[model samples]
Target chain A: MKKSIDAKKGKGPKAKLSNDQLLTLYRNLVRADHFDKCYVRRIQAGQLISFYHAGEGGLAPGVGACSFLRKEDILWPHHRAHAQGHMLSKGIDLKYYLAEHTGKTTGCCKGRSSYHWSFPEYGVFGTSGCIGAGFSPTVGWGLACKKNGDGQITMMCCGDGGSNRGTAHESFLMANNWKLPIVYLIENNGLAIFSKHEDMHPTKDIADLAKGYGMPAVIVDGQDVIAVAEATLKAVEHARAGKGPYLIEAKTVRIQAHGVGLPDLVDYTPRSKEEIDELRERDAILICRERLLTEGLLSQELIDQIEAEATQEVADAERFADESPVADQLDLSDINKLVYAE
Target chain B: MREITLIEAIREAYIEEMQVDEKVFLVGQDIRGGNFPNTTGLVEMFGDDRVLDTPISETAMVGSAFGAAQMGYRPVVDFMSGGFAYVAACEVLLQSAQHYFQHGGNVSVPLVITAGVGAGLKLANEHSVTPHAMFLHHPGIKVAFPSTPYDAKGLMKSAIRDNNPVCMFWHLALMMEKGQVPEEEYLVPLGVADVKREGTDVTVVATGLQVKHALEVAANLESEVSVEVVDLRSMEPLDYEAISRSLEKTNRLVVVDEDTERCGFAAELIAQVVDKSFDLLDAPIERICIDNMPIPGGYLEAHVLPNPAKIETAIRRVIA
Candidate 1:
């Protein structure tokens, strides 16, 4: 019998309550929310340079899936990556990411790849802006994991739009053929930029595509952290048991506009203020807080403490970005340092 | 001591390297029977896993090789022709070339992309393009255009072992041309040049199949003019040492190429000479390249390629 890890009340493992572990989860989610809020504000203030609108609210599936894994498990995030990276604290470097946005020397890529080209050492091999491009590399990493005999599973987070790409299909085929340990999580946020899921596929569930590859698929309410975490935990367990790969279609809502750009100002088919207000009440972080408080697991004082710490953390990250030194090298010849010289 | 076709030399190199290192593998279309005979007898000798056949997707093939290289595998990808290189350009330029720099030196791409090129046999417009200039312009890539079987075998071995992405072009016209090669394993490093013939009157520089034509032209003009022939084995990071030395020894110069004259290899060579060593030349540099037009197949090829007679005429004009 596997040892049950003590988690929040009505969350993770059924029995139990350690204030520390529960606090860790609560703090992580709050930090993630703080990071996303900071990121959006920076983009709005012209502080974040590479502002690609992948839509708001698409960060839940990544956060939920990553919350269950150990530090060793690598993640490959698609375009909407700030929340995912923040969840793992691997991509929480505000200075480097801000520099990357501003096309500054202090950026992660040294100003070479601005918005779309991402590289976060925090276990993110990099985000694929090319729709389904992340799929192949994710499968390759999963294959590497199998060959190395490492129990680490790679989680690839993609959007509903990327599900229709050929690379996605190919990755599924290759992952199943090789029996790689990977969890393919599709954040089905209802729309692919402008086109809705109904306008794209006949079957409402994005997991239907996984059937063609002979891989097991599941669907869950992405807004519910407990549900999302449970589904991801099950998938991770399956992969850890060497049962091959699995897919999870996370149904979530992106309350914010795609990005902090022109879309925020212009109205395409403008939603009513009331509809937007109704969606705002379903904020994942707020829902988690309410659930914990309602179940007597968390107090108002604890929630306030978590929020304060998250605010301070975000403030420190901003200062680090402000003071970080810029990379001065002109020629990138030294970039081939580790590669074999022929 | 042994004679082999252009493809056979490459096959021998692949066999020699695979036997030496288990990390090397071949992936491409129809390589089982050696698609273009470049990988002949490899599948049988190495088995299917090592010399695996791939689907007709160039992007996947190149991207897979890039991924494989990152995972400690040295992949040798063979495209049938230079035109097909365009299909794999994204993986080559964007992914393979940029990863080393983008990953902050955390990864390396030890992959060699090989293709047959040039315009003499007139395989027609699509097949016969000498797309060397495009590759030469890109940074972080090594371009090898071998004119002889010996150079092909040696340079290919170097390319396979290279850490960065390397493109080796084997001319279709020089596929059957025989040259002396040592039986032992040896490698000609990238950005090196070979002197095909020595002379003191006019330095005629060429690449790929053009090396043979330039040598033939030099021989034909033995009495009238002493023509030195230089073969640029690698295109990018060109061996300017050999060009400068040839120019210093021979006052007049002529650059012969199978591709069109506009924005061709010759144009760059001339620019380099002007920038670095213009005073060493006695006369204006002459360029003997094919006219600006698509290569025509069949008998029309005779007029499309820079032949010995054309190179000879260009050399005479430079000396006059």
Candidate 2:
């Protein structure tokens, strides 16, 4: 039996973004794509050896979910692309992010963290290297926001595979019981490393788990940035109004292997080249560009400019990272002092 | 000074800290109704908002603490029992412990974890296991196991005020033990050791309930063997200087721990002493512990769990 996909609405009629908003979405999508592509290129060239899960094919969910977030809104980035795409969309320092990836002293973490970027100054808490580590903390942050009576919302990101974990169940219960201002954005790429999501999860949609805890949620086209943002905006509004948590299950696809240097096989069945080509038919960046041109939201010239600027931005970040010095002996000698706060 | 049990001391510390700091809160299972006598009236005093009663979800509880700590709230998480910490091992042992170091040292996880450990309760394998060794092995967290009501109150207060993650364990056996606690505020300070009894012939170092056992053995052998009893209040930032200073006077070492024998706190203590103060030792060091076996059912635990008899024998062997 074919499971029907419904773009469930929450506290609003069919939501829509203005032409300018659509254009901004396109701009963000293009920038995220550039960052992801550069990340893949860097890994392929062996300029960096950090453990990474590429965010190229699965960039739309994070980019869209973060589109409406304010500077004060807290975010726990997903593991893919070292979370650079979400960081870029959320307005974090791009140079420090890249520098951290390359293990330079000017990095966001001062070269201490290899594949993590935490800019708490900008309200972006570095997601844990362990999957689903963000679930409970997001609830913690949301509880704080609700208690403070502030309109800040916490966007907690996790893969579809991690939705079945214990933290997910427990976090959902607490958020619902307390009516916290949290948005659980579950990005379903249909794979957990090599294990198929279908085999691991009993439910068809990850948001169903949220529903079990009496939490409100929606299912959207993961490849459509505008659709995701529109849905996320309604969820955010509901949360900002103190209506517990809202879950979003984005049915996306993993275009390649889980991480660089890992097998491309999904549960021992190799992902065919044809399969990847078919998945790219809905390339988020390309789709957004086409929509902007078709809807008269943006001209080809403007689209070209956006692409060029994003490319240049990524290039400048690469140069900044490459030029930064590696952390030296002095930093290593301060290990004891670094671990604890005096 | 007021006489109180270890549990009462811990409760008083929580009440005092929460009274002074608005950001300090308590979260655990059945804490509001006071599943244990310590937290019985906390909810009524602080209200449900601060004294959070959570479900049997260790991960979410710890995660909430970790998250609240990130937001500058000092959260004291009750695992109910020491073994329950393993249920959320990733949060307490890894993520929260390593957060500050991995996230550029700017963030502080000012959270306190308290749970009871030791085999006297007779809850069998799962509940009786002493899980402090794993926390001690992890670098970024502080491990403080108190042996007396006085130290328990002071250490709990210090752990609550600390800006780092601290795992504190009290022996279930010591819950009834009474000691003098000050009426005013005082902190034992994390990572500092206290010499429970001063002597001159041999040094017996112990932790948690074992400290009491070691102290008992020292008094019994007082006239025959001058035993100096040192209580290592905190295991992580061990007071190695204090240990070495005691060893300098006694020239013999014996460690008593109620936890496992191998790769546990006792082993770490001996390894550190041999490395830093090997010249101060005249006789080979001795360790009295549960030799690599889980604490069996109630009555059977005596065979494996370290007791006063084992400690006394170890002290005699160390000075033999």
TM-score list, all predictions = 0.85, 0.97
Query: Best candidate per DockQ, number?
Result: 2
Let me know the TM-score candidate 1 reaches against the reference structure.
0.85
- Tell me the deviation in Å of residue A198 in model 1: 4.5
Error of 2 at A212 (Å): 1.2
User: How would you encode candidate 1's per-residue C-alpha lDDT over A1-342 as one tens digit per residue?
Assistant: 111111221124432324554455566677777777777787777776656463345555666677657665667665664543433443345556656555666666666556533443345545434676767566556755665567878788887888887767767876786677899988887766656778887887878777677787777777766656667777787788788888888888766666556443213475567866776777777777777878787888888888898799778777776676555556647533433244
User: Comparing chain B with the reference, what is the TM-score for each candidate?
Assistant: 0.96, 0.98
Model 1 interface CAPRI class: acceptable
lDDT of candidate 2 over B1-320, digit per residue (tens): 67998999999999999999999999999889876667879888999899998888888899889888888899999988988999999999788898898888868899999998889776888889989888977889999999999999999999999999999998888898899998888899987899999999999998898888888888899889999999989988888999999999999998887788888888888888889888998999998889687778868878888888888888778777
DockQ for all models:
0.23, 0.74
Please name the candidate that would achieve the greatest TM-score relative to the true structure.
2
Interface RMSD of each: 4.0, 0.9
**Cα lDDT, all candidates:** 0.73, 0.85
